[model samples]
Target chain A: MRIPLSITDNIQEWLVSMMSESAASYVAMIIVALIYLGIFAIAGLFLVLIERRVAAWFQLRIGPNRVGFQGLLQTMADALKLVSKELTGTDRADKFLYNLAPYFVIISALMALGVMPFTKEFQAFDINIGIFFLIAISSIGVIGILLGGWASNNKFALIGAMRSGVQTISYELSVGLSLLTMILLTGSLQLSEIVEVQKGGWLIVQGHIPAIIAFMIYMIAGTAETNRAPFDMVEAESELGAGFHTEYSGMKFAYFFLAEFINMFLIAAIAATVFFGAWLSPFGITESIPWLGVFWFLAKTLVLVFLMMWFRWTFPRLRVDQLLTLEWKYLLPINLVNIVIMAFIVWQKLIIQI
Target chain B: MGYFSNIFNGIKTLLTGMSITGKYFLNSRKGAITQQYPDNRETLKMFDRFRGEVIMPHDENNEHACTGCQKCEIACPNGTIEIIWDRGIDEETGKKKKKIDQFVYHLSMCTMCGLCIDVCPTDAIEWGQNFENSVYDRTALTRVLNEPESKVRAGIED
Candidate 1:
């Protein structure tokens, strides 16, 4: 029998025993929110440092070695500098929307983090429809980009925002269908249930051929969704001079920057959970050590994160027309065919079991 | 068939590109092209032929080869060199001879063209490798190449 190591559940029971039910829930909610906020900030900072270091290596340069042991404190120094900078905007810009845009992006990313199964029972909000919740929440971040671009009163920013809207809408279809392909094998929307299903073998192994295809498509679409490079027409630095965030300065810009890295982490986390067996050790090597699940989960997620960074530094940015052509002409059609194939394999019960 | 081939070829090229970068990344410590300037000052050496500035070399007896012929002063395109001369009695020959009282070099006006060094009849001046020429005061750049009370070498011919 498998050991039940539910730390969050234990916390909930302890809180309920100490106080009235409603009061305990209120305190628990606040505590969980604060903890997630801390995770979001720290994860974003470290991802930025990792991205710079990886990029430096790919280009054959020593990146940021002076700041606190291989540039560990570089992002902290950058964040501090950003926090103290003057907040500036165009004189005639839409003040209300301009101020509100960053919150929409950051909050959506934080909400998506809520459902991530870092380990058994470690998730903050174990929603029943976890995959659907993630898809829905991720799409909301594009609205913030659109709003920030439009309210800046700059033509380039507006153009960038519009391109972002178009790109996200097109890529969202592939991301959804790819996940839908995997959902056929697992037959569940809950992330925790999905991980439990992978106890026998990872969805990638059991669902083999089509699962690999879906993963490839998912990675491609996910990179586009995050507005990262090779698909970074949204922030086409050479073309748009920082794109949608051209007018923003200081902490407001930090919110947009941090939200991006957080979104990247979310994409990698989702891929780890759904395809690579979330927190499950390979062949249950550490079955008795339940806490080791967190370690396994993060290790898998960071490998995928490094893969995304590799893509960012390796591939050149796609042109605007080329970007649309890729999603519509290439990715979407392949994605549709891949899902049907997955369905057939599941129906035939041809999956490899451990 | 053509469509499938096109996609396959595209993916192949992308992998090729990734392999090149991946190789570099793995060997980054050995492959980095950047030279940390100030940190590597101890090992930094300028090429021997690098024209930094003109310097007049003196012998152990505080004697130079310059007869104050003013050839460098005439060859200097920017008027960077000036020589002050005096008629002095040559002790060995009992005859009057022209000798430089002051051999002033204005580093600020020099373009490092090496024309003055080339025109020197007695090989009085040669290039110095000290290129740290920055100075706060403009007058500090003007230097006298000859030491005080120094004379031309005994065996030097006019």
Candidate 2:
């Protein structure tokens, strides 16, 4: 197959010309991984600032605008402060797992960033099982929260960890089923193929009610998966004293904090890629400028991210039982019915053709 | 049917909450109540009667109104005010009168209760309305209210 002249392909071509094929591919992989790491670090800081500012607006207060222009350096200053702090853990805590937990969370989040098709040609790895891989890897992040909580040897952290474990497992089903409903319409699990099929129009537009229903379910499940408000039982500070990572301090604590924002960005990016056209401009007006694909993709992802932040600030945290009931009783049944309806629509050729 | 209704009600409530926050967010341009403090100090104005600190009133001629009766000193619950007095000859009356040599106000100790202002027979002390009271040292806070080289106004009875 002739390789498309994308950014990744250019690097691959250069490396292959300079070195052996295997070495080239290996080097390219390392480069892409490093790029994703930087992207997550910057995106984490940006999303936190936006979330805080949006939250301030919701509550009729001005957020941080002092550190730099409009408080842009606030998160940077925060990162520096965290770096300077002494890492502290409980005396009886399991040292090994406590040190390892943040990596579990951060790695899963960064790995998800690699698969996202930023533009038509910019995905690090366009694996055939894109959606499934995303779902699998993203769900593993809760393991870090679980380990962090358990290793702390604190009851609140342990309870928080257990709650997160139950919450993620239950919510994963709804997230998977909802995405499955969309997959039925697209007939492909590969993210680029899904985005390609939506060239007819975004899936939410073409597939009608079932697609919209799937999107809503996906959003709710995604929010829960990220451990955000309304489903933030894992770190319900008022009740659990920051829940799972209660004993974590300094840079260790910052890793968990940064991972939460990075995970939020991943969830938003995935939703934008799969449901909305990943890099497609509205009405295909900007289709000629393929490089503008990155801009379009970021715009769509940020809008979704803002929507999630809105949900976070507006809604209160759910009780643990209520959270479980939300997934099993409300979201799960709706997802099942929605998938069936999507199947019927596809079988009958009721999907809108461009 | 009841199950569906319950779900609908739950969503409706959630939407209602979102709308309230959305209204505030959208109207933030007009509704933001932040003063931006130091930046707005030039335009910011305190209420006319807001009691911020104690000050002895002086006229343009550098003559003060204090007779040093010590009523304010007596009325202050916190002992935040001290009146130093000495008998002096009134220029107009040619009579010996009690006049304030110094009116010492320890702003650090002042509770801003306005009792001294209320009990002043000569209406010498009143609220300054200057609330920026932070100082580098405690001694800086202890202010002498009377301007240097000023005396009690003539024709004012002791």
Candidate 3:
């Protein structure tokens, strides 16, 4: 697949020609890293505020609209408070692992963010194995949850972490399978390539029933993978007090909190890219203006993000057994059948190609 | 068929739940119950019958209806009301009359039960709906109902 030339690509070429190729590449990596960090912080703040406001609306209350201009800076203020808080650990806790776990979770989420195609040319690493890399890195978040729980020396934390481990492992299959269903349609694993294929229409509209089923399955599994509510047995405040990060305080706790929202974003972004057209304007309305691709991508991602938030507010947390049953009994089987069906559709050339 | 129907039912119920929340989310413009507190203070009036605090109303001449009646003080379960009274000469009649020196209301201690207001014979005390009564000091919460240099209404002398 030929890489589409964008402003950033032009800058990269100029830098490589002017400087040592290796040094220029290193600088480019650093630049992308810094951009992603800024994005993570802003998106984390925005998503948390949106979640709180949406939850409030659903429950007939006004959420945090006091800090700055309808509570825009509420998360920023919360981050400050968390940073200033005293870092406390239990007496029997393994201090090293307890401190290290949050970074593991945060880094995994950050790695996933790196590969996402924000616009036609605006991607950090545009890897050929984008979906594969995303799936692989996202699974690593469970290790942090496990380590935090085990190191806490608390029974509730252990239970929460174990539930999280079980939940993530079970749902990951459905996430992969659903993506595979779409990958069959696109015949490419590259994020940009997958997106380029959607110029005909979105995979959802192109493949119809199978693609829609894949989307539904992906959403359920992705919500569980993110450890969000209805599937949030991991942090079930009513059952296990604060879950895996029970003993963590200060910025370490903030990392775990922020990472959840960031992961929620990655899930939505992926959904927008693979199933919906990544940065493709609906009916190519704004195709002439390349910069508008970023707008189209964000508008699509926000819609999916809103859907996830709605799920969090509307649905009750499933029990540990119920959570497993939901994935194993319902989602997993449906996903398997859906994939076979999608393959058949692709082979028969039933797709509504433009 | 049963297996597929069960899956369909599950999806249907989940969609049903989503629709309900979707209705609230869309209807939020009219359905939002939030009373934006400080911002709405200008128009935010409490109900007429709302019991917030016990207050004694005074007219333009600074004359109150309370004639040192000890009934309110006795009716108060929390010992919240303290009426300090002394015998004084009534200027018009040249006769000794019981007069109130201080009507001390310990607002912090008062339960806002309205019993004192109910027991008042002169109907001097009524529920005040000014609920924003937070104070910095405990002593600051102890309020004097009667204005300085004010006397009881002449008609209420019994």
Candidate 4:
């Protein structure tokens, strides 16, 4: 299933019941790490395949189809090829961070799953300020990307990494402001509690127009934060070869690639949680049926992922100046205003009568 | 004042931009551009002119019209073709002749130059639609002729 933390919870529960309660926490952490690696491998394969198909449709062209059924196994074949390929290091490249960056990026993204709520009952830590924790961890991923770019000793790599670092930091403000509105509405920052509140009716419906506006802002800022197109100045193929990780090879390169897709899913899942109401859909309508909420949660996330793919394929990459303008001049100010209005609404009850 | 105007303009722009995505999202039906390729390959039509693999044409008696002319090989810059020849004696005329043992065209190496067919004086070859030539073995690209030796002899006799 697409659920990340539920499996971790299941492991924790089994360990607690079978073994001592204290040791159960240790078992749970280990299980979460295994799941982190397992999910990253599987999801990266699926993301690559989906991206090719989505690009194909947008451009009215056929994508890879000969390797497996509709090229479903194409990424696995690519992974195999990558494993066998020899890694070439630049003669002048820094040996340490060049090797360390990919693992750092992957681990930082994996840390995000620790706070992400997959279902009502499943969360690793379920910190009261889970949304803030998620943002903080995702931001660390940019550091790894930046290190990889700088360590590569290539001009393009350095440029890509620096661009990525700046873009991520700037867009984070807008993303944070958008989520702050939801925090104001729910009044509690715990992810499970937020999902529980949405059980009666989703935040999208209950919070109404403001929630949707926040969602739109979140999407724009989130896309930019992840270094996804059209804000993908770091990986601009025309100007830069492979961007920040250009000098990386073998599983190290694969790790960086995995981190990107996982980060994409993280943003999509968190967006679904905060703004689209986590795993809730119209109470009794979905609650009566077992596993319906999980299905709806996944369906929502996949739709968001498809929208991301459409965006990457259809739009041209933005200039660095224009990209920052979009954030500072447009998204940041709008979100700032949105937060103020939302806070005002909560305090004064300015929401229109039904 | 300028800052507020900027913020206000942003909200308008964001809404206008979101409305476009939301409108399409709300209006979209099934067939969300997900094409199941193999299932749909029956309806797949490439224009008659796509330069894929080259094929040698065989007559009703299975005689290929190629006379082992090296013009196509000379014209090609990539050296994708290597026309192998086998010397043989005609049974009916007691005359020695040079025949193609293999008109080996490496599909991977081919740049789809179509010069091979154009240079063939006998109209013996043309581009074919069978593009499913990808394989694990690189050597599988050398296509053996469908034309029988008897038919080739008949053509020589004619």
Of models 1 and 4, which has the larger DockQ? 1
Which of candidates 3 and 4 reaches a greater TM-score? 3
Q: Locate the minimum summed-lDDT window of 10 residues in model 2 chain A.
A: A1-10
- Where model 1 places Cα greater than 4 Å from the true spot, the runs are A1-7, B45-133, B138-158
- DockQ of every candidate: 0.60, 0.58, 0.53, 0.06
What's the ranking of the predictions by DockQ, best on top? 1, 2, 3, 4
Interface RMSD of 1: 0.8
Question: Looking at candidate 2, what is the lDDT of residue A327?
Answer: 87
Q: What is the lDDT of residue A206 in candidate 3?
A: 89
lDDT tens digits by residue: candidate 1, B1-158: 68778778988998998898889889999988666668987877777998888899999999998889898999999999999899999888899888899999999999999988888888989999886789899999999999998999976763
Model 1 docking category: medium
lDDT of 3 by residue, B21-42 (tens): 9999888868888888888999
Each prediction's TM-score versus the true structure: 0.82, 0.82, 0.82, 0.71
User: Which consecutive 10 residues in model 3 chain B have the weakest lDDT in total?
Assistant: B28-37
When 2 and 3 are scored with lDDT, the better candidate is: 3
Residue range with the least summed lDDT across 10 consecutive positions in model 1 chain A: A1-10
lDDT of 2 at A11: 89
DockQ value for model 3: 0.53
**Candidate 4 structure quality by residue, lDDT tens digits, A35-66:** 65787678778988888866765555566777
Which candidate ranks first by DockQ, i.e. highest? 1
- In TM-score terms, candidate 3 sits at 0.82
